[model samples]
Target: MLKRLWLILGPVFCAALLVALLLVFFPTKLRHDFEAEKRSAVTLTAASFKGRMQKVQALTDANHRFVPFFGSSEWLRFDSMHPSVLAEKYDRPYRPYLLGQRGAASLNQYFGMQQMLPELENQTVVYVVSPQWFTKTGYDASAFQQYFNSDQLTSFLTQQEGDAAAHHAAERLLQLYPNIAMADIVKKVADGTALSASEDQFVGLMARINKRQDIFFSSLIPSYNRHYDQRVLPELSRLPDEFSYQELEKVAIEEAKEHTKSNDLGIDDKFYKKRLKAKLRELKGAQKNLSYIKSPEYNDLQLVLNQFAKSKANVLFVIPPVNEKWMAYTGLREDMYQQTVEKIKYQLESQGFTNIADFSKDGGKPYFMQDTIHMGWLGWLEFDKVVDPFVSNPKPAPAYHLNSAFFSKEWANYDGDVKEFGNK
Candidate 1:
C-alpha cells in the first residue's frame, strides 16, 4: 500500500514542479532571446527609414531620451546633421529622431504618434502638418492602417486619460496571451456560445482579426528591446545610405532634362497666365464650398492634439507652404487654402496649441519645393531656421507667422474688396 501511494504522489509532485518552472522561466526567456536577436537586426538595416524607426524605438525602449520630428514625405528634406532648434547654433547637441512615411498625412501622423507614445511621454516632439490634409478626402485607410493596426492599439486609442491603467492592463493581456482572446471567441462561436447573438457581433470579431493581420509589429514590443529587431529583414542592411547633397543635385538635373525633353517645361510667358485662368475657371465650376474645419480629418487632428495635451510631451506644429503653380494645376484656390489655414490656426490655438509656423501661403516659392508637395533643400533650410528657436532651451512663448505678405487674394481672383481671411 505504501509503495502504491509513493508512486502516485511522486508523479504528481514531479508534474507540479515542471509546471512551476515553465510558468516562471519560459515566457521571460522567450522575450529575452527574441530581443537579443533584434539588436543585431537593427544594424543590418540602419540606413532605411523603417530601420531608423526601429533603432529609435529600441533606444527609447531602453529609456534613452531623444527628440522626435513627425511628418510625411514633405519633411524628408530635414537635415539632422545640423543643430536642432533645441540647441545653440554652435552647440549642435540634440539629435532628433525623425519619424515619417510617404503620404503620411494627419491621420497617419496620429497613428505614428501612437506607435511612439510609450517612449515619447514628457519628451519634446515637433509635428509637421500640411493644409491639404484638412480637405474632404483626408487620409486613406491603407495609409493609416499601414503603421497602426492592432487589437491593443484600438483599446489604447479609444480610452481616456484616466484609463491609463486600463490601457496598460489591456496591453499586458494581449502581449502575454496573443490570439488567445480571439481563439476563445472562435471556440465560443463553434460551441454555440452566442447562437442567438446579432450578426454585428460576429462581423465585429472577424473584423478585429482581419485588422490584426496588417500589423507588421505590435506596439507591445519594448522600444529598446534588441530582440524586437528580428522583425526586420537582413536584406535591409544592403539599402543605400541617406541621400547626399550631390545625389539630390544629380536627380534635379535629370528631372530638368526630362522636363525639357517632354516639353513639360513651358517657356512662353502666356503659358502660366493661361494656366492660372483655366484653374480659376475650374475652381468656379466645381462650386463646392469646402468646410475643412468640420471635416473628419480635422476631427482626427483634434484627437491627436487631445492625446498630446494628455501626455507630458512639448509639442511644436509646423504648417509648410504649398506651391502656387501646383495649386493651380490641382485647381485649389489660394484664398480657399488660406481659409483652411485660418481654421487650423483657430482650432489649434483654441486647444492651447499655439506653437505654429504658418508658411502655407508663402507665395508658392519655387526654391522651397521640389514640385508642389515636397520640400527642396532650401525649403528645409528655411524650415530649420524657423524651427530652431522653438526647440531651444530658455524656451520663449512661440512665434506665429501668417505670411500674408507673401500671398495675395488677387491670385485666386477674389474681389480685392473682400476682407483678408483671419481666424474668423
Candidate 2:
C-alpha cells in the first residue's frame, strides 16, 4: 500500500519541484517584472506624484510646516516651478509645492489632502477651485490605486466614513483590478524595443494613455462634453472626407440650439451666446451659497469640498478661461456675462473664500488652445500674473489684467479666416 501511494504521489511531487526549479533557475518572463517596474517608474516619475511625495517627505523629515498648493492640471500650469513671483510679492521666502494632476477632479485633491494629512500638521494649504471642479463627481480613484497601497487608501477613506460619496469612491477603487496581462504584454513590447528605454519612453506612454483615456472616459461620462464653438467646430468641420462636414455642421447647430434652450439662454444665428452668459451668472451665484451649491455634479462635489474646508485647508477655486473665438461663435451676451461675474463674486463672499480666482474671461478672448482645453503659454502667464499676488500675500484682493495683447489675436484671426474660407 505504501509503495502504491508513493508511485501515485511521486509524479505530482516531482512536477511541483520541477515547476519551482524552472521559476528559480530560468525565471518567469521578464515582461511581467518589467511591466510592474515600468508602472512603478511611471508613478515615481510623474511630476505631480513626485512633487507631492517630496513635499510629504520634506515635511516629515524636517518636522517643519509647509504650504500646499492644490488643484487640478489648471493649477499645475500656473507658477509651480519658481517661487520668485510668490517670494517677491510676499516679501518673504516661499516654497509652494504643487499637488495637482492632469485630469484629476476636486475629489482627487481632497483625497490627496487626506492622504498627506499626517505630514500636514500646522501646514498652510491653498486650494485652486474652478467652477467646473465643483461639478465633478469624484476622483477616478482606481486609476491611482496601483501607486498607493490599500492600507494607506483605506486609512484615508476612513476619515470620511460617514460620507456616502466618499465611501462609494473607496468601494469603486477597491473593486478595480489591474489589467496585468495587457500591462505585461505592453511592457514586453516596450522593453524589447529601443524606444521603451528611451528618456521619453515613460512620457510617451503616459501621453498615449492620457489621450486614449481622455477619449474613452469622455465617451463613457455623459457630462464630459467638449463644447465646440467657432474655434473647434471649424476644425472639426474641416475633417478629411472621411467625415461629412455637412452632417457635422448640422449636428453642431442643433446641439448649440439645444444647449441654449436647455439653459434658458437665447440662441441667435444658431449660436448659444446667451446660454454662455447664463452659465457665467450661475457661476457667480454659486459663491453666495456657502453650505450648498448646485453644480453639474453637486452631490458628490459638496461632500468633497466640505471635507477639505473642515480639514482647515484653504481652497482656491479657479474657473478656466474660455476661448474668445468660441465665445464669439456661441455669442456670449454682455449683460449675461456681467451677471455671471456678480454671481461668482457673491458665491466667493458667501463662502468666505477670498482665495478664489476666476480666469474664465481672460480679456474676453479665449485663452485655451483651439484643439485642446488647456491654456496656451500666454494664458498660463496671465493666470500666473493673476494668482501671483494672492500666493504672495494670501490676503490681498487678487489682481487681474485685461489687456488685448494678453490674448492671441493670431488665434482669433485664424478662426475668422477659417469661417471665411468655409463660407467661400
Candidate 3:
C-alpha cells in the first residue's frame, strides 16, 4: 500500500515542484504574457488604461514625496500641459499626477485610495469628489473588487492597518475575483520593469483610446437623446410640468420603477433618469444623516479624512464641475444643488479639511459633448484652469512639490502641451 501511494504521489509532487521552479525563474516573462493578454482583452481604450497604469508605476518608483489628483473622467480631462502653463504663469514648479478613470463613482474613488495607500501613505492626495458620488445607490462594491486584487494594490493595502483598509480590502477581493486576478498578473509582470513609459507612446496611446471611447460613446448619444425625447419624456409628461415637491417625489418613485423594468440598450432615458433620481435621494439622505451624526457612509468618509489630515501628506478634495445644461435637463433644482453643496461643505469643515475646494458649482459652459458624459478639450482646459494653481502652490503643511523632472521630459513630447491645444 505504501509503495503504491508513493508511486502515485511522486509524479504529482514533481509536477508541482517543477511549476514552482518555473515561476521562480521566469517570473517576469510569465507575468508579461499574462498582462499583455489581459490588457489586449480589455474593451476600454488603451490610452486610458495606460495612463492609469503609469500613475501606479510612478507611485511605485517615486523616492521623494508625491501628490496625486484623484477622481473619475471629469478629473481625467485635466491637461498635464496646463500644469506647465500654470507653472509658467505663476512662475512656480508644478508636480501633479492624474489618477482618474471614466465611469468611476465615489465608492470607486474610496477603494482606489485604499488600494493605493501603500505608495500614497506619506504622499499628498487631492480628491475630486462630486455630490453624485455620494448619491450613487446600490453598494456595488464589486465594481472595484478587481482593482483592489491587483498585485500592486494588494501589496499596498496589506501594509495598511485600521478597520477601513482591512474591511474594504476583504470585501472587494471577494466581490471582484477575476479583476483581482488579472491585476495580480499585471503587477507580477510589471515588477522590475520601468514604471514609466516613453512619452510619445503614452500620449499617442492616450489620444487613440480617447478617440475610440469618444467615437463609441458618441455614436450611441443621438439614439439615447431620441429615445429620451420620444419615450421617456412622454412618460414623464404624465406628471404635471409644474409639480409640488410631494407630487414630484411621487413621479420620481413611479418613474424609477417603470424605468428599471423597461431597461434596454437602445434608449434608456427612464433608466438614466431613474439613476439620477436615486442619486438625488441619496444626497438628500446625506443631508438628513448629517443632522444625526450617525450615518455610516458619512462616518467612513470622516475616518478617511481624519487619517488624511494627520499625515504629512497634503490632501485636497475637489468637486468636478459639470455642465449646467445637464443639471437642468435632469430636473435638478437650484435649491437642491445648493443643499447638496452645503452638506459637502459641512462635512469637509467638520472634518477640518481646510485644504478642500469644491467645484461642483462652477458655472461654466457645457464642455461635455452632446448626449454624452465626457468632457471635450474645452472642458479639460477649464478643469486645468482650476487645478493648476492649487497644485503649483500646494498647502505648506502637506509639503507637496511638483516633480518637474518627470514633466519636462517625455511629457513635452506628447500632444498634451499647451501649444498643441487648438490644432486638434
Candidate 4:
C-alpha cells in the first residue's frame, strides 16, 4: 500500500515542481506572447489607452522645460502650443506637459503624478480636477489599468496600509475581478519582494487580456489621425508658427457654422435639455446620500494630498467650471455644491495647499462649453485666462464664487453661443 501511494504521489509532486520552475525560470520565453501579438493587431484610442504619455516622453526627452499638466478629457482641447501663448501673455517662460486622459479619476491622476515626480520635483505642476471625481465609486480599476502598469498598482497596494480608502479600493478591485492574480501581489508584499521582470510582464499580460479582451480576434485593428505630418512638426509647438492655431481656429469656425444644423452628434441644445431633465429626475433621491466626506474618492484624495504635501512641489489645482443646467439637472444646488466645494477647499487648505481656482459655478455660458461638460475652443480661452496667470506666478488665486441665488433660478433654452468668439 505504501509503495502504491508513493508511485501515484511522486509523479504529481514532480509535475507541480516542474510547473513552478517553469513559471519562475522561463515565463517569458516559454509562454506564448499573447499581449504583444494582440497589441500588434488592434489598439484602442480612449484617452487612457492612447499613446499620450509615450508621446509626452518623446517630447520631454528632447525638451526639459515641459511641466506635467494632469487632468481628464475635459482638458483635451487645451492646445499644446498654449504654453507659448501663455509665455507671451504673461511675459514669463511657460511649458506645460499635458497628460490628460478620459475617465481618469484622482487616483489615476495621483499615480500619473508619481510616475512624473521622479523627474519633476519642485517644478510648478498644474492639475485640473473635475468635481465629479469625488463621487462614491471614485475610479474604476479596469479603466486605470489601461494606462498604468502593474508595478504602479503594486506600489500603491503595498504602501496602502492604514489607509481606509486604499484598503477599500483594493477590496473593490478584488471584488470586481476575482481572478486578478492578487494573491501573488499579496505574497510579494508579505515577503517584501518586488515583482520580477517576468512576473511584472505576466501581470501586464493578464491585465490586458482581462480588460481589453486581447485574446480575442477583434484586438488587432488600426485607426488613423488626419494631418499626421502637420502635427509632428516642431514648428506646431510654437505660438508664432500659426499652423495649429489656424487649424483649431478653422475647426471652431466650421463647428459654429454647423451649430444650428443638428445631426447625430447629440450636442444640440434640445438634446442637452432633454438629458438634463432626465438626470434631474434620476438624481432626486440619490443626492441625499451623497457627501464628499463619506466618499471612498475622498479617501484616495487624502492619499494624493498627503503625497503632494510630502513632495512640497509647486502645484496649482484648477477646479474646472461646470454647466449650470447640468448641475441643476443633477440635483446639485449652488448652496449644496458650494458646501461640498468648501469641504474640499478646507481639506486642501488644511494640507497647506494654497492655490485653488474653483470655476465650478461659472454658470456654463454657451461660448464656454460645446456640450454639457466639455469646453469648446472659446471655453478653453476663458479658462486659459485664469490658468495662464496661475501658471506664470505659481501662487494662490482667488476662488471664483457664484451666489446661491444663481442656482435657484430656472434656465430656459440657454444656447451657449458667443458671437465675439466666432468673430475671433
Q: Judged by TM-score, which candidate is best?
A: 4
Residue 38 in candidate 2, Cα distance off native in Å = 24
Cα deviation of 261, candidate 3, in Å: 34
**Predictions in order: lDDT:** 0.47, 0.40, 0.41, 0.49
Candidate 1: tens digits of C-alpha lDDT, residues 1-424: 9999879898998998875554344321112232432332222221223322353344354333346676766533322212231132233334455556665565445544544455566666688877767656545655554554443343333332333322322332243335544444333333334423553355455444433332223233444533223322321232224534454444444433333232222211233344444564455424234434334455556546655665656678888776666565555567777776776676577556777877786636534554455554345555666666566552423332222211221222222222343322
RMSD list, candidates in order = 13.2, 20.1, 18.0, 12.5
For candidate 4, report its TM-score: 0.57
Candidate 2, run of 10 with poorest lDDT: 400-409
Q: Report the Cα lDDT for residue 83, model 2.
A: 26
Arrange candidates by TM-score, highest first: which order? 4, 1, 3, 2
TM-score of each: 0.53, 0.43, 0.48, 0.57
Summarize candidate 4's per-residue lDDT along 267-319 as a digit string, tens digits. Answer: 44554556544564566445544543334555456556655654556677877
**lDDT of residue 252 for candidate 3:** 39
Model 2 lDDT per residue over 1-424, tens place: 9899989999999998875554345421112222221122122123334223334443443332235665555433222112222222333334445556665555455445555666554344555554433322323445454333322343343344333444434433443434422333233332332223552455344433333332332223222112212222233322233333344344434443433343332222222343345465444433222211223223334434455445554455555544444444445443444334444444344445566566656634422321123443344444555555554554322232221211122311221222232233
Regions of candidate 4 where Cα sits further than 4 Å from its true position: 1-64, 77-95, 145-147, 154-178, 182-184, 187-294, 329-331, 393-424
Better model by TM-score, 1 or 3? 1
Rank by lDDT, descending? 4, 1, 3, 2
- Residue-pair clashes per prediction, in order, are 16, 19, 2, 5
Off by over 4 Å in 3: 1-19, 22-56, 60-66, 75-96, 114-118, 136-138, 150-157, 160-300, 303-307, 363-378, 398-424
